[model samples]
Target: MTELLANHVCGRWQAGTGPGSVLRDPVRGSALVRVDATGLDLPAAFDYARETGGAALRALSYAQRAKLLADAAGVLQAGRDAYYAISTANSGTVKSDTAVDVDGAIYTLGQYARWGAALGDARHLADGEAVALARDGVFQSRHIQVPARGVALFINAFNFPAWGLWEKAAPALLSGVPVIVKPATATAWLTQRMVRDVVEAGIVPPGALSVICGSAAGLMDQLQPWDMVSFTGSAETAAAIRGHAAVARHAVRSNIEADSINSALLLPGHGPDSEAVRLLAREVAREMTVKSGQKCTAIRRVFVPGALYDAVAQAIGAQLAEVAVGDPRSEGVRMGSLVSREQYDSVQKGLAGLMAHTDVLHDGRRRALVDADPAVAACARPVLLGTRSPDAASLVHDMEVFGPVATLMPYRDLAHGLALARRGQGSLVASLYGEDPAALAAAAADLAASHGRVHVVTPEVGRTHTGHGNVMPQSQHGGPGRAGGGSELGGLRALDFYHRKAAVQASPAVLQALVPA
Candidate 1:
């Protein structure tokens, strides 16, 4: 029998009482481990986290909690090699792709640690200077941000089990809040292992961080009115979470990262040989091929000048041609399989729907899998679809394939391109590529209303430009509308989600004493 990945709840590792669901290696289709959280006392877990873990964490100064986060990062970094192996077997990621998830998690944690330390020993943050309420200036009102007295529940997606866990945990822990992580069952191994390592390291208070795998049933029901939940997954599931009693009736705070069809736009003036066109093609291809394009921020839409459509497609297609899809351990395999057979079928179904409104620019679905059988291996090849008339194809504008797939659409000019990009309704990011500063800025500004981040790439940036899909900790990672109006990871702004802000109206002396001097 495969060993069940135990759930860490109520400050202890507890095994499920029933036969568990099996997690398999995507490439070999072999069972890797089992996970089941059934029969665990979730209400007790939530209470323990809120009463014990939350109290212990909230008692620490911001600087102390920051040090704890740094220690946790070190624990993960020390065992990084083991994470890489798990990513390969369970996440179906190549070495480079695995590094993005594992290393990215470590980097985010360290960044938060550094920032949290700068906040000093303050347990609560003054929003700004106190405002005088009386002419004598004796009475004043001060706004402050304090750690929530409740727990944080993270419902993560499978594409980035490692990064997703830490990106949210870093801020939550630094803000002196306990977090319970429910990573996607498909790729929970890495999350479970990382949490185990950190907990055993004794870096954090017991119950400060917990991992519950398998069923998410009754998890949301465990949330209290003051507790919060950060979810990343399909929009449908996000809706269900929002409607749950804890959020709908009890007013439990929620942040959601749902379906986003992010885009990359080439300024109208950029011709086929222009740097803008080259940059857009390169970045879009990278986004599609990276992690086999399972990223939430991956570029799903490409907008270019009408005259440059064929050139853009051909350029992106040529680069994607070099990619070899197969087992991650296989030498020369540039890409690996989807996280599971279910994801494989979902992508295929989405691809078929997209094909109805567009023509195939580069079809790799027929590409041979390297060192793996096509029947069981859940691999997919990079595919680019082009639609000349994007306005008519409403599905192309809004649908997110969520795999190594993208749609190319040609626009009349920059204005037309902006209009089409906005048709995405809302997105996590949109990149503008052009040498004309004015044109790039205008396009970026226009896209900004809908996108959380606008990536501007000019020839001057050259190789220095971070890829369009790289969700840096320095910038915001969520978007409005269909992208799920959730804000995350904008440096210190991330701490806001884990905190509760209030305006305290009191005497000047009392207000002054409430926060750090």
Candidate 2:
């Protein structure tokens, strides 16, 4: 019998009733573990999270809840070795790729802890200065935010099982909302192990952090009016989650991170030999191969000055050519297999669809794997596509292959480039590479309405700027429109999602007393 990974909820671990689903190793294509939630009671678990976990967390001040996050970070940091092993085995990620998920989660949690503690002993957040409702100072309305008396349900994507869990949970827990995580089944072991470690260490209050694995069949069916749901996956599934009764009728808040054909633009005057162009080429290659381009923020489109198109392609192709794809444990493997066979098939389908729309400037798919068998491993080499006709390449701007694939296109001018970037409709991030500060600023302003975050990388800051796909906790991680009109992780703003804001019309004295000093 395959080892069944247990679900942790209601202060204990329990296995599902049936044989359940088997999760295989993507690199070796061997059945490694099972995840089954057939007989677990979700409603009971939700109730416990609210009644027990939520109550305990809310009873403490923001500072106290923040300490819980800090302590949990310590616990996970101490057990990171196990997480790395599981990441390589189950997700087929290289050591550096695993660090992005594991270390990134640890850093984000610690960042939230520091920020939350700065809030002091406040139980609620003051939205703004109290506005006078009366001519005299006798009456006024003060908007304050209080932790909602509900639970947070996170349905995470496969590419970031570890970071996804903590990125959502850190803010939810800091805001005094208990969290129940449903990690994508393909990479549940890493997420499951992290949750178990935290729970066993008693880092979080009982029922404050729970994880459910296997089928997500009835998970959305268990939401309440006071609850919140945060999902990271396809736009189709995001739509279904949005229309679910919990959200449509009961008014449950939902944060959806759907399809985003994120772009990177090279500002005018940066020739292929310029430092700006060199930086863009290196960053593009890094984003494409990192996690095999499974990241939502990974660059899917490249918009460069029309004159420098070929040079840019050659530079990026050269960088991508150096990457080795195989089993992560192999000595020289820099890229690993996709999370599962399903992802491999999906990327291939998406790649084929886009290939018909663009020219394959550089094809690494034919390259041999380092130590992995073609039939057993789900490895994918980086492929760069290009098109001379930007106006007609609708699929290039619309489709996201979600693998080590990216399409490069030429734009006439800076304005034209910004317009081309906006063709993505909306995106989580759009980076601008240039030496001209004025041009960079102008292009950034133009793209702001269509993108959630703009990463401006100049030659001066090339070494210091965070990479394109790296989602920092200080900046918001979501975007508008097709990218999913969701907002998260803008420092204290993240806590707003788990909090309910209300305007209290009361006496001046009472209004002042409602907020922390």
> Best-fitting candidate, measured by lDDT?
2
What tens-digit string does per-residue lDDT give for candidate 2 at 1-517?
A: 7899999988899999988888899989999899988999988999999899999999988999999999999999999999999999999999999999999999999999999999899888899899988898798999989999999999999999899999999999999999999999989999999999999998888989999998898999989999999999999999999999999999999999999999999988765699998999999999999999999999999999899999999999999999989989989989998998888988999999998989999999889998889887899889999999989989998889989999999999777888899999999999999888887888899899999999999978989998999999999999999999999898989998999999999998798689745
Kindly report which residue stretches of model 1 are placed more than 4 angstroms away from their true locations once superposed: none
Clashing pairs in 2: none
- The runs of at least 3 residues in candidate 2 whose Cα sits more than 4 Å from the true structure, single-residue gaps closed, are none
TM-score of 1: 0.99
Ten contiguous residues minimizing lDDT sum, candidate 2? 508-517
What shift in Å separates residue 56 of candidate 2 from its native position after superposition?
Answer: 0.6
Can you give the TM-score per candidate against the true fold?
Answer: 0.99, 0.99
The CA lDDT of each predicted structure is 0.92, 0.93
After best superposition, candidate 1 residue 77: deviation in angstroms? 0.7
